[model samples]
Target: MGAAEATDVESEYSSLVDFEGPDDPSHPFNWSLPRRVWTTAVVAVLNLIGTAASSIFETGNGQFMKEFGISHEVAVLGTSLFLAGYILGFLTFGPLSERFGRKWPLLCGLAVSSLFDLMPALGHSLPAILIGRFFGGLFGVAPVAVFGGVLSDCWPTAQRGIAMALTVSLVFSGPTWGPVFGGFIMGSSALDWRWNMWVVIIAGLSATALCVVVFPETYPPAILRRKARRLRKKTGDESIRTASDKEGLSLQEITRVYLIRPFWLFTTQPILALLTLYQSFVYGVLFLFYQTYPVAFGTNRGWATSLEYLPLLAIIVGIFVAAIGIVIHNQLYFRHHCHTPDGVFIPESRLPPMIVGGILVPIGMFWFAWTATPAVAWASPICASVVIGAGMYLLFIQGFNYIVDCYTTMANSAMGVNGSMRSIFGTVFPLFATQMVHALGVARTTTILGALSAALVPVPICFWYWGDRIRAWSSAKVATF
Candidate 1:
């Protein structure tokens, strides 16, 4: 009660409040399981909506072209621009999350993205719709950046495989189902191109509401740092400090971390560099197919309406089937042996599924390209789509797991770089797809893509064999198994 005693107590409290670091239990990884799962689910849902927005308007493209009196290429820009916005958004959001914490940035991004989704419905002008789509993609990238980080934050390496599988499944499902659902909606006499945007907006709003209500802060450093600040304020002590507070890089330092590290990893680590290139190509091919499919199915086959291609839902079914195979492979790998020589029991050991995916990519492409003729049964291209989807899911899931495993704390930055590369390809692929198909025809164009995909198959095997050496030589920091 004495003045001296009160001063001493205040000094003690200040010290306690200053303490911060990785070991703090308040971090998201240390949260109870139920809370972490809820956070992960919210992130997955947000990602679903973001991806859904990417291609939800595919079925509506013809309608827009007619309504706006625009060329097919110009209308397709709406889809391409959304992806470009995602690329632009990735550059900012990853670092922002690192600085401010995940919750606020994610919420703000989702709210804005959802609002943009509504803008397309408000006007008939092409510019307005394009602008709205661009902004939606811009905000949508927040979930893309944050979701992987959230998984890294809450789940230890062991449990991350299944969590990642599920997250990725949801993300892919959005785009996969986008066209299917869009077809259904557009097929309905009651709806038009605008309905596609509304569907996305509704989905975004629902996900955002759930996130706001159920998701809690999960980043450990941010949580503990806040707790330390509060404790300091209340107790009037000075000694307590967090590891992050003591060693936490300044904003400039963090920026340096983000900018410098990925390049270093890409340049020095052949594995990363090659993987980035390969995955970039795969992504390009995937988006290219988005443009190509309608041409092949709707135009070439003389499907009376875009809705006739609804049977292409078989592609998504293929992806889900491949996902099941991935899960089975993962379980089998774990059951046999769980640890590497280094004594690290990495769940990354389950990456063998990628090999299956690698095989599927080229095979599916070749099949679809060759069979995409009016003379052939429509079933031919649909079957090829199944193979391509299966292959894509396999490759994507493996690549994601590989990166997350390799870059533990820095996974967000790595993913941002990967996303940037992927988006660059996504943006470029659509622009040239028509030209490519025109020049080579669907079969030859796809044959080239398939061959390119085939070439990359060996890359993963090389990584599986020599990944350790490559990681050692690379300057970029990676988690050791």
Candidate 2:
């Protein structure tokens, strides 16, 4: 009788799922393809909304100066403060995901970020606007810190290439798109720059609601824990536990692991250090283009304000074209090598295109720089923007994918660290962009940037050849490519 009772208890305990096993329906990895795509799209929109909040206020710079009676320097601090919030946010949100799970942290971030998005419009003072922007950015961490992990959780290694392609395309294109739409809002005679914040508020609300309605819980351990809890309650036993729960994590331990791991990875990992430097510089240059594009096309070329944003479309075109090219390349070269039976994909597979991009960045920069004179056909320099855009977009995608591969399970933290530096660069570079052009002239500024781009050309090549060796040295314990 005792033996039979023990057998009953053991059989009951087996009902709780702690990890994904073969053909487990509850595992995100085994979710339907349509469900995964929908979730990814919602996550992408979340990214678009949060990131757009960072720069939709770019148009407000001149107006803020005019109305608030602030200097150009002080007015530009709006951008700085918004991005500065991202720096703090990216550091904490990923760690938060590790502890609380991806769903709640992401929803909370959107809600808080949306609240602050409207503050700039409501408050009448410069201090109020700046404070709101900083908080808005701080709270907008969900898309940046959590989305990469969501993609990792839902998609396998092979499918992640195109999934990330869609993601990076939307993300890289967001800053450029912000000014395009914001210019229209700012251009309206009936309204003022404050409406830009209203637009962002609306976008945030839409994305957040879709997130809540469409995206279910994605973190594996979190799902299992809920299952375990259900089993415990159903069976009148308290012993039910998930694999993650088995670790018995404390708040202090989670805080340390999530908080310190990113900085630790940044400092200790050579791959992250070099890639961060390169990605940050290129990302900074992207924001600086916002300063340069208006000059090169608007004032220098005498284009209408209504039509000035058309040049940016060329950059957008380049971004999508590069994305398409990558998708095709993945099919041709990566169909087999990108996936393995054990779910490992090749890391260096992301590098060939990066090599091409490294070369194109300087080429387009120089092409646009020397030919930017009014006498030259605008088409020449405009076409050059496509090249530069493609190069920048390609580098971003490759760098992001390579790092994700290097640290699969920890991809979110890897991106968080990468994004923090990228935010820093985005914040600092724009502050000086106009001054650089003013001091050196557009040609010299572009040429100098091109020179710097040329100098960093070896980054992808070095990574392509020596990346395996570098990963071998890392303490992250990644699989061999």
Top candidate when judged by lDDT against the true structure? 2
Candidate 1 Cα errors over 4 Å, as ranges: 1-14, 17-35, 229-254, 304-309, 334-338, 342-351, 475-481
The sequence of per-residue lDDT tens digits that candidate 1 reaches over residues 403-459 is 766665666667777888788887778777877887788788888988888888998
RMSD of each: 5.0, 4.2
lDDT agreement of model 2 with the native: 0.83
How does candidate 1 score on lDDT?
Answer: 0.76
Please write out the lDDT profile of model 2 over residues 217-294, one tens digit for every residue: 999888888888888889868767665654556777666566777777787788888888999999899888877877
Q: Indicate the residue-level lDDT of 204 in model 2.
A: 83
Best by TM-score: 2
List candidate 2 stretches off by more than 4 Å: 1-16, 232-236, 250-252, 337-346, 475-481
For residue 431, model 1's alpha carbon misses the true position, in angstroms, by 1.5
Report the error of model 2 at residue 269, Å: 2.2
